[model samples]
Target: MAHRAASGWPGVTAALAGRLAKLDLYHPRDLLLHLPLRYEDETRLTPIAAAQPGFAAQVEGEVAACEVSLRPRRQLVVRVRDASGTLVARWLHFYPAQQKLLASGRRVRLFGEVRAGFFGAEMVHPRVRAVSAEDGLPEALTPVYPTTAGVAQTTLRRLIDHALASQPLEDHLPDDLRRTLGLPAFADALRLLHHPPPDVPASVLEDRQHPAWRRIKFEELLAQQISLRRAYLARRAKTAPAMAGSGRLVRALVDALPFALTGAQRRAWAEISADLALPHPMQRLLMGDVGSGKTIVAALAMLQAVDAGWQAALMAPTEILAEQHWQKLAAWLAPLGLEVAWLSGSRAKRARAAELARLASGELRLVVGTHALIEDPVMLPRLGLAVVDEQHRFGVRQRLALREKGGAGAISPHLLMMSATPIPRTLAMSHYADLDVSVLDELPPGRSPVRTKLVSEARRDEVIARLRAACLAGRQAYWVCPLIEESETLQLQAAQKTYAALCEALPELRIGLLHGRLKAADKSATMAAFAAGELHLLVATTVIEVGVDVPNASLMVIEHAERFGLAQLHQLRGRVGRGSAESVCILLYAQPLSPAGRARLKVIYEHSDGFAIAREDLRIRGPGEFVGARQSGLPLLRYADLEADADLLEAARQVADTLLRDHPSAAAALMARWLGGREGLLRA
Candidate 1:
């Protein structure tokens, strides 16, 4: 029976379809693209004497003896013999049917890794199938596919083979382009990948270095580039308010700053300003190292919107960071006769209502808050710009909701995303291709360099002593713990326990505690006390990893630092070193460090550059985890390795632009095949 690409298999039952859904196989076309994770060789057989231990080989023999042995455990043991020698096959866990299949005098073919067992050479739970002497060896290696729990490898292979036979495998790229790029034909590549010849070097295919693999990777990347580039073009076609604000507010804020803007900051602002003045909605990402003065640039951009008689809003991921931004922006703008409203979930009901009312009426042009800003009650009728701080901390839908707040009567607000975590180049090229990027590479003048030290848990006492010394000398310090509460499984230090211990260790110094569970009022009081120099030391969790900044706080001690990620460690260290005084970050790690833990700590200790540390983090954790692909709403590359296939990525990028401009139909077809309607998520 003929099966359509979207109709799925003809005889698949509901139960079978449910299992296929778990592997994301909804139609026949999906099975065609379900490439093998690895392949097993079964094209030839080896004699018992020629079989090598620790290597997988196919061997044929007749079962001389079969028995259920209970000596070591319940198992099925079968002894097979050939003209050359004898081999034993054992199954620790077996069924009655399997035992009958291996009955005495039956000819069988075994495929598995041979091992040196106590009795003799053995194969553990190998693929045992009854065969006749007339049966011939296969012509090609068998394909093994990634399958779900209910779906067996053999079942998947059968379904995919059927799809390959039924589905149309046509090349979308023009012939000249494919030949110029030295890529193989589309149909040939898929057929070869599914059933490779016996002579093919397994290493090249396994490592994805073969020509067929290249074609697959290139096509996958091309689809991604086309999706992002098309999203960019689609966004430009939409209309937005042209926020060409007079330079009055921008100049006043710039002149009022204590220090001049760095060259990198100036360049970033110029690019942003130019985008804001355009008729199309601006989607730009402002990336800077920790403590590189990103907030001021955001303030200037917001003022540009306000100067054009439009409302502006900023959203942060957490309450603490939002409050920090609100405080700073208020302090900077209040002196210039502008009122900034703060909105948060924990605010008093009456106060939140008042802010929401003002926002909806356009009386409040500038507001900063957490996710509460995106709630249904809050509205910004004339919002011309929306800025999201630490944008990766938010999910795609949250950011989209904030943008929709300004979508009134065919007018959409421009968006500016700010991230303290530096994105590596390869990631920026693939994941963030839809957004224009501006980087603030320079730190402001007078920012002291922070010295990082790695200390073993045995030296905890020394680190505490150093902390006490620094605090007694009128310098504040932060003690960062990994968990807010006790976790018996992790055994890491908790903030409350560390707070009580530090208070007992140093009675003369005033200390404070902060964590996420605390009430909003209490958290604010504790943070305020620490920032105002009322507390000499503060014990906190990773809640303070990003926005809490105090110049007087010149020392930081991170307990169980090995448990923290590279980006978190860097942000926590940035809390200090804001003042002229020399700052030092002490990483207190436990014993028996893992290899990955050691690598992370080493990267943080050796490099103070955020970009350099980010590159290393990408290498260690890969692009998906490093940038939070789920939060960004961008599908990751399934076949292409950003580092290994960078050349192919560049080639795909160039081809994507050409396809979009000259061959729009081909571009759309490619996106449909690979992305499968998931490209809509990139609109946000």
Candidate 2:
């Protein structure tokens, strides 16, 4: 087949080409990949009398009468009659050209939702296409596409038809592979999914489980798997100075800690230690429950690097978290004579310069900072280990940049990405496929579980009384509102208003307000006051969800808790219960909760395990909304449903591995077809 110029197509004008460009469809191959959203069964026509009300119906009939009426707010009414009965197609707004097309005696096909109106069996503004005597009706379902504002469905279809007719598509899937999977050829699959033969059941096409769709989906999943595998290979190809440690610093730190390490913590630390000792830079993810002492494991890894005469740096997402880590690390390491330096956006210029200088000289054995550590000026010449805390908050590029901080020649800094949010096994396997994973599944000892309860807004007074009593008992509490300020769209309480209300309700107790809109200094002061037990109650927003760790704050009252995701609710609840004192998390939800909201609250209330909550979140909110997917830049799966296509995904992974091993060239072609320009980035 010879290719045809898209501009030479019957309906494709320069303007149409420009519009198609907006859709990123340039070459014939791009147009071929533009799969339809759905197909409408227009092959068989429904008689006017048999048309179901409020259901889409397609009918072909000769126009018996056509006229524009001014009485009913100026509508063009076309009456068409077939063998069964007559139906009226009404359009409230129409151009004079449309009236010329709708003249009487003209055969036309009408498709739209039929409804009972003043005129019985009427279709309001139905899709109207003229039918000629020589025109043959389509023998298969009509494809409905996602189009831009300027491009119409008919014009798009014509352009696609031209492209398909002229372009010769090469099937990239190996013949054996296709036969083993029971899949159609690449070109054949494209044609089947686009046109879809009349014999193909509508339900199968709708679910996108037809052989054609599955084949395309497998190709996509294979591309992703291939890219991830290539990334792992590429990173491993580079040389990294082996961080073999004498276990001196690690042993000393473990002995110095007040509490003994849990079995899970010890295992996770062992894994990290082993990875760091490898010749290749360690690309690993450390996931743990909210209070699961992942920090200790990270500390052990950093200390191991320091023991090997290499510098280590830890980067956090927020300045508060960076400062929090610095405070804890400085307190722990200062006594051991290991210098720790801090850098953040809020750090003074002089202090930041000093820290950078110290890092460059390798005088700073352990460095803690926010994104400032990744900036060009802040160089760590001997950086052997780079720890990214709350890894989900940073992008892929940021993580790679931190890895490039040190190591001469091709060597790169070892990376240990840490997250307090526990990820479900399914998500971890797919999203973190390229990296090794270590999970800290157990919490530290003496950390009691936070008792969760749901409270109603109707009992606001009782809740206020309880909070006041809790405060008066020499304990601190947190009142978390969903919004920083009053939102006109939402009826949830604002942090500012809630703070004022709490002050008035409990005049004897000290209260502080914290939200994102507050100045950095003010926010830090408020958090400091709350942490020092100066403020009995702290009214805040979700900003405190991750880093504001006050152990004395035993009671957490989350207002309008229904609006938060399961992970967020769990994190907010984690802020409390850090102390030995008994802690309670009170979820105050608005009445008449939606099904999803009710389910989220119930999951949070019943389950204390972050991993279980993560799985439940994956089930309720789905893959797209899952924290792992949203944060990890997981490739968008067009036909592969994360839940329904789990088995297919596994098969694709195996196939990808085999193809890459046996036929590298074929794997490359597959990656080119699916990943396009993104293939290079994945290699990076």
Stretches of candidate 2 exceeding 4 Å from the true structure? 1-14, 407-409, 484-493, 517-522, 591-596, 620-622, 627-634
Q: 1-684 in candidate 2: lDDT tens per residue?
A: 122235654556787777887776756666777889888888878989999998898998999999989984889999999999999999998999889989999999999999998878999999999997677778878998889989999888887888789877777778988898888898989998889877998789888888898888878888888888888988898777699889988888889999899999999888888888999888888998888887778888999999998889999998778878888888778777887898877777897888788888777778998888888998788888899999878876777788788845567888898887787776665666788899888888778789999999899899999998999999999988874234633423366677888888899999998776667678778888889989999887777888777888899999989988898899899998898999999999998999999999999988999989989998997776775444455555555766677777788779878888998998898776665554444412
How well does each candidate superpose onto the true structure, as a TM-score?
Answer: 0.97, 0.93
Best by TM-score: 1
Q: State each model's CA lDDT, in order.
A: 0.90, 0.83
Model 2's number of clashes is 0
**TM-score (C-alpha, index-matched) for candidate 2:** 0.93
**Tens-digit lDDT track of model 1 for 1-684:** 122233447667778888887777878888878998888899998999899999999999999999999988988999998999999999999999998899899999999999999987999999989999999988777888888888988888888888899989978898999999999998899999999999997777889989999999999999999999988988999988999989899999999988899999999999999999999999999999999999999999999999999999999988999999999999999878999999999999999999899999999999999999999999899989999999999998998899888846688799999999999898888888889999999898888999999999999999989998999999999998864234633323366678889999999999999888789899999999999999999898888988998999999999889989899999999999998999999999998999999999999999999999999999999998998888877877788999999999899999999988888998888887888857757838
Best by lDDT: 1
